[model samples]
Target: MGKKLFIPGPIDVRKEVLEKMSTPMIGHRGGDASTLQKSISEKLQKLFYTDSTILLSTSSGTGLMEGSIRCSTLKKAAIFSSGAFGDRWYKMAIANNVPADLFKVEDGKAIDIEMVEKVLSTGEYDVITITHNETSTGVRNPIEEIGDIIKKYDDIIYCVDAVSSAGGIKIEVDKIGIDICVTSVQKALGLPPGMSICTFSQRAIERAKQISHRGIYFDLLAMYEYILKKDYQYPSTPSLSHMFALDFQLDEILKEGLDNRFKRHEDMANLVRDWSRKHFEIFTDENHLSNTLTVIKNTKGINVSNLNKKLQERGYQIANGYGDLKEKTFRISHMGDYTLDDINELLDNIEDILGLLNKVY
Candidate 1:
């Protein structure tokens, strides 16, 4: 059996969901494909808590991140960063030649709401992007509170990268005043990697129309118009395999009930957080700990790679720290289809491997 995955992305996929990926191919331009896309969109809209149009991409969440910044930023974008992924958004802006500025906080800290207010108060930006969850440091920004700050600026288009937290945490997109919210199937959605999804608001569409040079393939306005004109079909051929699995998995997710699924994630996260506190130390601020993953500081100076090796031998695997935090910190994901029982099993294995079974808290 494959080692149980506890990483951020590419988390363990359900057996039933994997089977759906092989449900035969369909003509990408046909009615069946349109119907499938339409179905997925509707379910996603419910998941996202928004009335905005849903857009699908065959690329990872980064594709739509680059697209959103490129297409919506008519003047300049105020990109906020609390960790690695947030820094990636700024890089996307630079790569796309979109005028932008990065507002960053120290690692493991949450973005100060007042800093965002200060940036927007300058009236130097027409767009803003926030990473709702930073898996790198296990920090979950208070976007709802940030949304309140952004709502005061009607002209500022707010975009959020919910790549790691969407399905696991509750995000009321419309109520939060987010014009663009991006996520992928690989994280908390309990599906394999390859496809990305986003909510595209009319305000974002209007902003895209104002920008003349929105890049081709990832252009939001173009994709939005094509879907409407073509009756829910994309301009490019999509991954029919991922669509099949996503369509089936989304149903399972809805059937499980949104509230119940969210509670499961919260329960798992709490379990891990408590374990981390008892053993090592949580890397991120306690006030903004992620509901999907926990980044634990290597306070004991234990060999993380060796621990993971031992874990793999025991049919379980967790993630080492990301980027510069590697070895200094490690992560344990509680997202996707993982339950409280699953978390207990993984922690039990870690304790055995690290010989922490009787270590006093």
Candidate 2:
């Protein structure tokens, strides 16, 4: 049996969406490709709530996240981390030899607005990176509130990793003054992994001009320039297959209505949260719980791998805790096209396996 995916990313893509990937190949630099890219960009504007330039990269979301820092920051980057993914951004800065500092909140807790403001007040940082939703910890930071503080400093570039949240959650990228917002197709877009997208503001373009290295492959400025010059084409050969799938997926997403889609994700997440509290504890705080995934603490100290084995037998697959949290917690994703009834079935199976139906926790 093909197990259903309830993991953080590469979530269950609909059969129709997958079919789009089988679309006939097109010339990356041809007019046909331009039309496809343009269609996807316009739809993405609707998704991101931004009038800024939308740039598509034929790489994972990490590609754009790295470019955001390397290309846009002329001074130092202040990276605020909530969990493993957040920490990865900080590591990227160091590995690239970018002048950066990393600060983190209490494990699994969201970054508070006040905490962000305290760091920004120093004026020592030229850009700040925030993870809108951290998959590893199942914590959703208050990017809206953080944006309010960041607005006070016009020069600081605000980069957000919305990799796990974007299409699944409503984030008004422009309203929040996010200079660069990154998200991948594999997460909430209900598409296979490969292509990633981001909104690139004019401010970021100008900032990129000031930075020297700004690596070539993932250069944000290069991407923005190419899109403008070629009229919705990328500097390098693009992922035409993913573009075909993305264009189709965007149409489906719009038809469903963005608000309704977000609510659906929320409803699924809430069900998982309630189920977790009834048996295992939620790894993150209630106020900061992610609407896309729930990480449940192993309060019962069950063997996570064994549980996954049982789940696989029943044709469902979930995620183990990431990094150090492995075995300490287990995650159930509620993102993409997953519905409430789908969540119910998964939970029913989990309860039965854990014997929780008879108070097995």
Candidate 3:
């Protein structure tokens, strides 16, 4: 019943995007569906800044995360973690019987590039998973710089989880040499959950061809082969509604101007960071804070759950800390279609609920 969503995902969908989702569904394999899929793919290629093929998944971003690790990993994978989502990728790897070793940094910090270099130097891994933005810790890894290092090994595939940063921030997929870049509709894309998008390089497709155990539902090789025959449509019934919304949403995003959108997110993130510094400590590394979300350390010892309950009563929502960090911190997301005015209102509400009118910035 809230007018806004300040949580990490399923952010406030614009009225236009919501309306597009309501358009009448067409047969998934028909001309209409192919047109919709082809259009979205082309637009997404622009968003990703790559000429590589874009793949659509009816499931969430995690589905493609799993698929990327499953399909592209030939010998082994080096899973890098900055927070919970990165850890989830490793979990998916083990669950699918994909051999992988996890590398994680301390909480609130990103994995060092030197560490990544050291690990990759061992030549034990053919695939690597990196999170562009860790929503849990509010840390944005330096993927471009890291990608430069990873690219030298042509045989190695680098898969990036950009679920929370793709549209809100600029990710030059080709420049970064990302073999597989995965994202979803709910976060920075400013659409509802249910649809996911990924850009896959030809190198990744070739690797998938060598792997016999890549699951059917998420087989990148199958997706590649089927789309070659059809007009960029999926093997199964695609979510036409999500595609409709995405087609429209991508237009709005491009019109808004990618640089301007990135600037807006950066501006809002700076505002929140300044506010957090004056009030409480930021959970993530200051140098690598995420543009889409801010995690504030609960230094003031306020009851975050109670505060959120009060916030809900006021028709607003914010996320409490995640995993082991719960109650120690709270997150406020700046992604989606939200503006600075929206964030100011949310902060005002939080200040009022905490009785920190004087304490809060």
Candidate 4:
């Protein structure tokens, strides 16, 4: 059997979902494909709690991230970053020559709301980007609170990268006034990596219309218009395999119930968080801890690589900390279809390998 995954993403897809990926392919422009796309869009709208147009790209979540900022940022952008992925938005802006500035906080901390307010009050930015969940630091930003601040600026387009939290956490997209929210199926959506999806607001489309030179392949306005013009068909040939699996998995998600799914993720997160506090220390801010994954401080100074090797022997695997945090911390993902029982089993294995079975909390 494959090692049960506890890493952040491409998190163990359900066998049924994997099977759907292999179903016979459909013609890209056929009516069957349009039906599939339409069904997926409707289900995603429910998942996202928004009536905004849903766009699909046969690329990773970063593809839409790049598109959203590039297409909508007419003036300068205020990129508020709390971790690595947040930093990436700023990089995408510069690479696309979108003219932007980056506002960052210390690692393991959520973006400061007051800092965002101070920057937006400057009236220098027409667009703003926030990362709802930062896996590198295990900090889930208070997007709802930040959204309230953004609501005060009517002209500023609000975009969020909910890559790791969209399916697992409760984000009321419309209620929060987010114009563009991006996520991939590989993470909480419980499918293999290939395609990404997002909700594009009318406000964003209007903003995109004001900008020129929005790149062709990843252009949000073009994609949205193409779908409306061609009956939910995309501008380019799409990934039918991923689309097949996503349609089936989204139904499964709805069958399980959104509230139940969110609660399961929270329960699994709490299980791992409590375990981390007892065995080591939680790396990110306690108040802003991620509901999808927990990053643990390596206070014990154990060899993470060796620990993972031992876990592989026992048929389980978890992630080490990302980037510079590697070895200084470790991560335990409870997103996707993993249950509390699964979290317990992985923790039990870690305790056995570390000889902490009899140790008192």
Structure candidate 1, residue pairs in collision: none
Residue by residue across 1-361, what tens digits does model 3's lDDT show? 5457888998899888899989996898788888888899999999999988999999999999999999988789999999899999899999999999999999889879999999999999999999999988999999988998897788899999999999989999998899999999999999989988899898998888889878888987899788889988889888888999999999999999989999999888888888888778998888898999999999998889998888888888899998988999999999978889888888889878776766543
- Model 1 residue 145 lDDT? 92
Q: In candidate 2, what are the lDDT values of residues 239-352, reduced to their tens digit?
A: 899999999999999999999999999898889998999898999988999999999999999999999999998899999999899999999999999889999999999888
List model 4 lDDT by residue over 21-76, tens digit each. 89997899999999999999999999999999999999999999999999988789
Tell me the whole-model lDDT of each prediction, alpha carbons only: 0.94, 0.91, 0.90, 0.94
- What TM-score number comes out for model 2? 0.98
- Which ranges in model 4 have alpha carbons more than 4 Å from their true place? 359-361
Clashing pairs in 4: none
What lDDT does candidate 2 reach at residue 160?
96
Candidate 1: stretches off by over 4 Å = 359-361
Per-residue lDDT tens digits of candidate 1, residues 60-139?
A: 99999999999889889999999999999999999988999999999999999999999999999999999999989999
TM-score-wise, the better of 3 and 4 is 4
Per-prediction TM-score to the true structure, in the order listed:
0.99, 0.98, 0.98, 0.99
Candidate 1 lDDT (Cα, 0 to 1):
0.94
